[model samples]
Target chain A: MSVDTASAATTRAIVTDAAGSSSRARRGGQRHPATSFAGIALRTPYWVLTAGLALIFLYPLIWTAISSVSPLAGTNQVDGWGFGNYATLANYQAGI
Target chain B: MTATLHPPASSPAPPEARGARRPARRRRGRRTHGALAGWLYAAPTALFVLLLFVLPLLLVLQMSGSDWPLLSGNQGPNFPENYQVAVSNRFFMDSVIFTLKYTVLTTVILLALSLGLAMLVQESSRWKGLLRTSILIPSALGLASASLLFYVIYSPIAGPFADLMASWGFTFLGTPDGALWSTIFLIVWRYAGFYMLLMLVGLQGIPDDVYEAARIDGASRWQTFRDVTLPLLRPTLALTTVLCVTGSLLAFEQFYILTKGGPDNSTITIVQLIYSVAFQGPNDLGVAGALSVIVLLALVVINIAQIRAFGKKAED
Candidate 1:
């Protein structure tokens, strides 16, 4: 809605210039059609770099999730796996 | 009104116009009916607010003036005594200062960092969607849940980053400063995406032609950001600041989970001190209620001042 609502200047010229544009201000006009495979190839580094950075935001939770059931030393996983920790939690605080 | 609705006197009324006529009497009746329906729809929420919020607030106010013990419940009114106790409590000043520090630091860091991330995401590259989703993923989790996750993550004994910290000889929750910064890091990580989303909405609402114009004017990136974007983003920044400050001031769950206001109670927030007074040591619910009322008053004042500041800026 915002994108379409901003139908000000016909930004065809600016949008096409995105390949050559390296500045933040120039990125206002984006979403140009991929004219060649070279453009797609060029964008792969950005995807990789950002996706890798995204992992920094994500991996802690993912790690905690994995470790929650992986028999960590201090957990209440009495039976070595499967619902033991949850059962213990259910019984915690005088059965809630 | 009748003359206007009836159209020209010279012209015969169209059948459609005659059928669609909205007479004042009928309109009034319809307004009454609509009002009744609106109230009917709103009744549940009104009742909920009454039961959950208003009653609790009133009860807290009552407790603040009365000798409300944890086990024996409300003893007779001890007006001004509880307030005196609350103000004179050992942890009051420290917790207030700590809460203010946390609030200020987190507000500045979160707002600035989120604004930067918003600009980074503003570019409609293909990674825009992917990066937005990933960053926003943390915000989907509850604050308490995120704190719990961080509590374990900050554990040097079994944490994923245990060895990394061990190699550096730094433990996240060992020193008071470490605890504060670590908790702030967790907070920033968890909330950055949410604030970024807010900023992004603000950013997107700016017409592309503004940027085009600025570009035409040959303004530098920083100049454009300062002159154009920041000024326009004031409303969003105000909202974000209020939310950040309020949330930080009322911080409890994270400190409770991660440090328990520990390393000698260095991280105890105002809410935590209130909790401590209510549930532990001397266990005076009256003092806690008094503390709660004071906090509420402070919050109201702070929020009003913030809004006023923002309003003045916007006027300028």
Candidate 2:
């Protein structure tokens, strides 16, 4: 019973400490709410732009990956997907 | 008993005094030993550099002054004649011009794209890791491998976008303009990430308080970037610019694999010209050696100029 009571008291202390810290953080945050909002507003567009550019930069690799598996790759006609292109590597002395 | 038997002048020193004196002497000896060991450890690398680099450089210089043939041996010192022949070659002159043009274009595009990407990645809040990794993935690919991949992409028949591009009436690697742009695009794709990493290091080195101060002063984004970021990033920019310029000047592999100096040798670089001269038919190894010497001298001069320019700016 004493051990249980001790653990319960510690948990209460932790909860109160967390609440106290959060309240302090909230007070600090409220002091410059407008600046924080403006900062986010300024950064949002750049974040979107970053994501778009990343996609563009990665497009070639993505295309290469998809083409490696597609049956139409290196051929004029598009067809069902197969591993024939990869399997053909076994025929070459260099082994790809 | 010994202390009592011996006179004052002949008596041995006390144990504590001897102990202190011994350590001082041992420490001095150890310092010398440590320095010797350090040099010993560095000797192999120094010897390797001397044998591989210095020896070859001297040999090349000697060969440049002689009429070194492809099939036979050197025919004694020819001196300025080999250099004169290299200078007089129209094809060599054309290759040099093309290399300079390519270097300027590649350096400008790579630096701009890398700086822009670095800034974007640095400012990003949520997807910074993902964006950086995706952009940097291409840099992990070997240059030759990337060139081969791009070769397939630039193909008229085998490319994934072949039909789509054909419908648009545009060929990527068929003509001179198309080929040059395609090669530039490939290089930018391959190296932008690597350079971006350099610029990002420069960016992250900047303290947050600097930006905070700029913000407090109500500086616009462009103003802050110009006044603060660019000045601070000068050293990194200098390094990347020099690397890009030198690498572009010596470009050969991509052009060799993709175009073979194609659409009329328009894309041939200085190194490619040297390779052809030394190895190809009508092989002139002496002229090639001279050309190599000229190139090495030019590179050294350019690097020195760049370093001096950056060093001056850093002092100011």
lDDT of 1 by residue, B35-79 (tens): 999999999999999999999999999999999999999989999
Best by lDDT: 1
User: How accurate locally, in lDDT, is each candidate?
Assistant: 0.87, 0.85
Interface RMSD of each: 5.4, 9.8
Tens digits of per-residue lDDT for model 2, B160-261: 778988899888887887899899999999999999999999988887657656665668989999999999899899999899989998999989988889
Top candidate, metric DockQ: 1
How many clashes would you count in candidate 2? 0
Q: Compare the candidates by TM-score and give the number of the best one.
A: 2
What is the number of backbone collisions in each predicted candidate, taken in the order shown? 0, 0
Candidate 2, DockQ to 2 decimals? 0.15
User: Could you tell me how far off, in angstroms, the CA of residue A3 lies in candidate 2 after the best superposition?
Assistant: 56
- Per-residue alpha-carbon lDDT of candidate 1 for residues A1-96, written as tens digits (9 for 90 to 100): 677656543465555443245453345443444556776777678668778868978898789667657665567864465565676777889834
Segments of candidate 1 deviating more than 4 angstroms: A1-52, A68-96, B1-31
